[model samples]
Target: MGKLVTVGEAGEAVVLERLLAALAVPASVSGVEAPLLGPGDDAAVVVAPDARVVATTDLLVEGRDFRTDWSSGADVGAKAVAQNLADVAAMGAVPTGLLLTVGAPSDTPLAWLEDLGRGVAAACSVWSTSVIGGDLSGASELLVSITALGDLQGRAPVCRSGARPGDVLALAGSVGRSAAGLALLLAGGPELAEEVAPELLAAHRRPVPPVGAGPAAAAAGATAMLDVSDGLGVDGARLAAASRVHLDVDADWEDQHVLDLLVAARRLGGDDDPWGYGLVRSWVRGGGEDHALLATFPAGVAARGLPEPFVRIGEVLPVRSGWPAVTVNGDDEVVGGWDVYA
Candidate 1:
């Protein structure tokens, strides 16, 4: 949409080759050495040093996962990669390579595609990963799919079912900021205002998942691990169900970031008592897409070894009779987030 440069009459094969070069070359220049056998083959050959490769795949569909009007091609690309990489990290692995597939309409501009490639490369470079291979195709709308591969480095892959009673629940990275940014976009903040906070806008566009915290938690003997792709309440419930334990989140709500969101909501025409009625609190509880790492560690382990950015917010409890999987301040009704079919 910005400074359009169409694919022109170059045809699909030529354009596809150019696109792949644009994506792979920069990553290579940035010291992202590809595998022994890289792209342009029937398939990419990746080495799994520890003999166990953590692999995850995610798809971002236009109008479903993102909107063209609100997000640039680069934003879409980065978001797609972040979500996939976070999944790999959730298994306590270091990401090594990524395979991307992009489908777009014929009329989609070449510049947009180039920007997307740059975004993909930049995202991979953040974690020292390489863009190994991919495919391009024509479609009715934009669709980006990414598959990430990681190395466990001889450590046991952490699973969500390992949490036990008396474990401490901790969060690495932030929550509710993306949802607050989305609320701003929905309230006409981006279009109506000449200036918007970069943090709020970036939160929705390119979420920076806590990549380092996953392995750190694992090394610190974390029992259970998962990324907060969905809202805290929903994902916490999932962890509870998987571990067969009750997660009790009892963090104080007076943090400065939460207060800032409350002020922003009021300015955006939300009720004055956003916190009182659970509107702001709900975002912290049920907001999704942040991709933060939520992990459980044995009591003394977390206190003594869990590193920076990992803050204790809750504790694990034994599964009591007739109790829900997750509860906040002893309340069980706070469960809602992104549901594709809902």
Candidate 2:
């Protein structure tokens, strides 16, 4: 049997060496060339095509951002990378590089750390990019921070402020599954078996955002876009505030987004929602962590004309003085969203 080792036993140099080895992937297989310079360098260099770079970063702290009991090291690693990369794509850019920084206590296991490295490599392998550089630190708990860089390819970067009245409010990817999964975990209903709702549990542990949708939306002339990490209610409001417009989310129950959740709700006995309203609708409105893309397209664009994976969930409206910036319908009731402060 192999002996289990901890970070305290290996020291920083050996630990870093092993982790770097685990992260190494061949360009031939990954279709992603190694960075100009990678780990062990003081700083890594990445080509900024079109002379413009799009960068985004996210900080994940134990307990606050993720729970160790709910996620493995690989799950945490992949989720951190996915969230940051989704942000870069939201700006209408292709991810080109990643930088990972990890802080862990000495008692952490070497195998767990290697799994984290492998997870990062697997996530980055899906694209033509690699982790360029990173730092290690000793801390009381595990912390993961990732910064992802992207290339615009001469295309203008999309921002949240570009949506105007008459634009179509569309969504790419999904909603509520992550929150639903978390709800299931907390509720632990009699029917919460793996066979019943494996997808929901998987959604919470490892969210796979549609990475290409961001750039595709930009190519399709998306006026504004953002990553849906903080639920539609919160992120939609941010977009509305930035664009000084109103968003009316008319989530057709027949829409695919709601339909998919309907199956899940039925699987979990409908009334299992810890949130409110219809279980599926509540999750659809407030679920975050799916890392989906929410974008605005110009008026006159047919819902069918939008690119793959995008569905018209709502429309842009003129800003009202005191009205809520976002409404599920004409009225602003039965709202749901994620709030760190709340």
Candidate 3:
């Protein structure tokens, strides 16, 4: 890895090639070969194996999506890539390339930017994807926009509208840890040394989405699928509404993991009543940002038939009268999850 040149050391004349070279070298070393043309060209040309493409975009702002006090520049960059790539995965496609854009103030350190590039390269390498091209510009606050492309490989794109009655609701990865981490940070819990809290704190800093589970579910004949970016209650409701079916979730509150988180929450001394069942349930059921995959498979598919890391948690039901989109433990209704406008 090349040593990052700081802004103070580089002076006023910002050479675009120097910055791009710093990024491109690591990308090249990571086995990121351009399908047609990579950086240093007007544009990149990527091959689509199935004559179709799955694309999605997401933006992350400094103050709103992240904070330097809590997260390093590399964490932000990796997270930005992971979220966008997960969207592509949700469509049952293989991630191929990414186009990243960074906007920052003049005072932003070049070293920080270099670390961000390394983060991006690292994430791309994980999925065997490529950072084809991107643009950089000046802005008021640090902003990152990522556009990801994927190949379907002749499989139909899995959507959220295909779930039906009798389908088995399953989850690919764990949840609630990110929200708990956020709560800990907000309550200054990280400042206090503790055993289990650091894991939660790491989750908030960088989430690991189930990048391969989406395609696995699709291959296993998943009827409907979506990533749990928002809270499970909110995103589950959206899936239910889209499929016009109801989800009856029976979260295992007695699970060991849930119990551990509850203990951590209480130790953090947050404003919320961590000991109460309602608050704990809120974190497990309504807390978001984990980016786990919630999918529905056909009824006949047994546990062994499904992919690894996927566990059954609920079932699909007919929309009954006076019932909300999603119900917890057969009675408790979840009205909403995270709301940006709220």
Candidate 4:
């Protein structure tokens, strides 16, 4: 199990001060410019270089979004930052600052908060971003909420609906990894899968999204794009609906993704059953949370070739006459995803 010290030991009064230290960034090391001003006022002041802010926020609560047994405070911290900043990146913008607010029970460990802050600081460091300010409070369960601000630097924000019929659908990173990892954890967990798939645990605990690829696609002339936080079938359909086009995904069981899923099934000690393939298919098509970047490039940009980290996965087609907007191998494939209420 992960190590931690209780908040009771730190005392509620001094918690903020200590946590702030953990959240502080090393601008020199990270290459992220220091904020105009950090914590210590009614509000923090941050610059919007493009004079426009691309803002997005997300909420993660215990039990619903994560389980304490599965992840540590640091993992949740890094994860919270990732999900929000990834939205900023998908807009083809660079994150400049973040506003974080967390609520936790009194029994919650002080180390958890410190680790959470450190996690946020660490992930932000990669994108040259920093957390300027946030709030702390008492609650029955741990709750993490963050709002990320980004700079467009004079480029048009890539929307989810700009894809055209002739555009090429592409993916910057593989999806279903988190799903595969989650499956392994359910089948046996870290102890059982120690030798078989340790990487699966890492994938589930901390997801490193292709934040840089969004900008690269923007530079390469991406027409539409989004982070595959929801499974591809669900998210891809969203993109298709918004762009008024149809998305046909490539489906070849011999594909690398399928092979990877097969590996996970073997770890579960499952025999070669059709049900195993079905589970893998479900994960590949619907298990979102890997934070892969999906985009559509116009034929013009397609001719010159797409950007690095993005490989052609499908093609934009005319919208369905009256049904699903996303398909596989030119036919209908059931769409699934991690909808909060679904």
Candidate 5:
């Protein structure tokens, strides 16, 4: 269990203002002693032993990104923290804190916000971190904005521009699960009886990022890394452009089979082919919710201390001028990835 700070106690619009004042502690930074005077006294300060800070933020709109019918306040809260934290992880930084800003209708139950706060607390607990500050406002629909802060621990911050030719590309989580779940959601009705994988639905609702892998990848001297918020094809091309290299993955049906079976089950329940309408494929390649980490490593570099949820996916090559593509083994179906803005 974690501590609870509530709007009911602090009154509306001022809860986060007070929570910021309560998060002070003592710790060490780069071998120097420091106190965590988080989010109070005008601004929070930390021991910048290396004079650097890593940070990122994200926003999710209610209908554009999620719907209350498919998720709970807890799910939204965890996902809000997970996606931002994963960005820090992609840079091989250890996430230290989070600041959340939430907007919802005036008629919203305060308990829902409390559950959301608990979700933030739960996700932070995975990284041994906390939500040090936030802002709340009333709106017509739910909007969650989160900003994550991280520490690099004296290493150069990894960016997308570091992949070299011959680097073995690796991914640190499963793909297409969230996409498969979305296919089930769109094909709704009384016949929607397929049992979606709890984790896959959770992935779409409350994505649990691999928090430890970033440091592990950095320790192993990974060349380039990123969180796969966008489709793999789009992100792959981004990395290619950043590193001046080409990325190629041999498309395997084995992975697609899982997505296929899930969709087939949904169809067997008498739903239409919404999954085949490019929702699942585009999402797996383009969706932005399932915050998995994508990274490149030197060839034959023995990975250390990595757990399940990661696999080697492809390789890097010298940069060439053409559309980056994925080829299905023995088939000529060349599928590119998804792009939000196109």
Candidate 6:
């Protein structure tokens, strides 16, 4: 470990000082109302033209949530933004602005910071959202926090608890690939990794959230919807509880090719419990960071823009008086997900 240094509290520009300098000011945009002493002030006041405000935040820390060696600064920035933005989308809202905070050591490369900024800018541009403001500070490890604001356009906000019995469980993106990529990274199987595609690793490192599916699902008569952040199994359980319905995931129901790829990745990694690592089982139940769209629709309603292989993994059962267990292949199983407090 490196020696710890504490510059006197008297040092003019302490850790927090340089960080603010790096962040500078928010990007220029119109209709944002007057700054009215933003950021560095005691507090900030801004007008919300819409009576409703959609808000979500995510935090990324070095080594725990990400690694510098595995992901570039840009990747980190993009991932951070994507996760929070996805949350807004889950509520069936459109992201309008982001407030980001970054913490890094003084010796961190300037290029890295520039790349991080570029990453944030690129992601914001993709969704047509702007970085309204943020904070910067020095820390022992790199940490990125982003809060996204969204607008619902007077539509009802879709939540997890609205599903009724007989609703159809639907998904909008591929699962297990991110977990598979992580497995390949751990095994260091360059040959097999190539087949998985280095970009797939980006899915784990910097996930491409399904930005369009949220509103589409809502418009398509989705009774309930959520972004699949935690593994499918665990998040599904959450929906089941909120909606007071039992969710049964037919792992056997997924496409053969997708299952085969997951099995192959597991073999390459030599993991005895392939399902536990967020691919077969956990991803089926416990995977996280996918940001895929999972929604429950009223029977007979057609979902729009649902791409190929967007399978109906499960269905909502009536609110029964029993433990909310996810049944897989005829056996009830525990929901696979990380213990945040752990």
Best candidate according to TM-score: 4
The sequence of per-residue lDDT tens digits that candidate 5 reaches over residues 18-47 is 333222222231222332665545555554
State every prediction's TM-score relative to the real structure: 0.92, 0.92, 0.90, 0.94, 0.80, 0.80
RMSD each, Å: 2.6, 2.7, 2.9, 2.6, 5.4, 5.2
lDDT of 4 by residue, 1-342 (tens): 133367766666678887888888766788878789878788988999898989999999998888888888788889888888779889999888999998989889787788888998888887788999888888899999999998888899999989998899888877887888888777876675555677767777788888888888888889999999988989998898899999988776225676766777655545656347767777788877788899999888878888988888889999879768788888757489765875
lDDT, candidate 3, at 3: 46
Query: What's the lDDT for candidate 4?
Result: 0.83
Clashing pairs in 1: none
Mark the regions of model 5 whose C-alpha exceeds 4 Å error after superposition: 1-35, 46-50, 189-194, 253-283, 302-309, 325-342
lDDT of 3 by residue, 116-197 (tens): 8777767777777877788887789989899999988889999999999999998887678788888777766557423557
Worst 10 residues of 4 by lDDT: 1-10
Candidate 3 Cα lDDT to native: 0.78
Candidate 2 per-residue lDDT, tens place, 183-211, comes to 77666642472555778788888899988
List model 1 lDDT by residue over 48-118, tens digit each: 99998999999898988888778888888889999998898888898888899989888888877878887
Q: What would the per-residue lDDT of candidate 6 be over residues 1-342, giving only the tens digit for each residue?
A: 023243223132443444334333345533333333455665554445568998998888888788787778888888888889889888878887788887877666655665677777677766666566787677788889999887776778899999887777778776666766666666664445656566667677778887767766666667888888877777777888888787766655554425644654555534665543344544445557868878888777744434333457777776556655456544567466776567
What is the Cα-based TM-score of model 1?
A: 0.92
| Position 336, candidate 5: lDDT | 45
The order of the candidates by lDDT, greatest first, is 4, 2, 1, 3, 6, 5
Q: Which portions of model 2 miss their true places by more than 4 Å?
A: 1-4, 189-195, 253-256, 262-277, 339-342
Show where candidate 4 strays beyond 4 Å. Answer: 1-5, 269-275
lDDT of 1: 0.81
Rank by TM-score, highest first. 4, 1, 2, 3, 6, 5
lDDT score of residue 73 within candidate 4: 78
Output the lDDT of residue 151, model 4.
Answer: 86
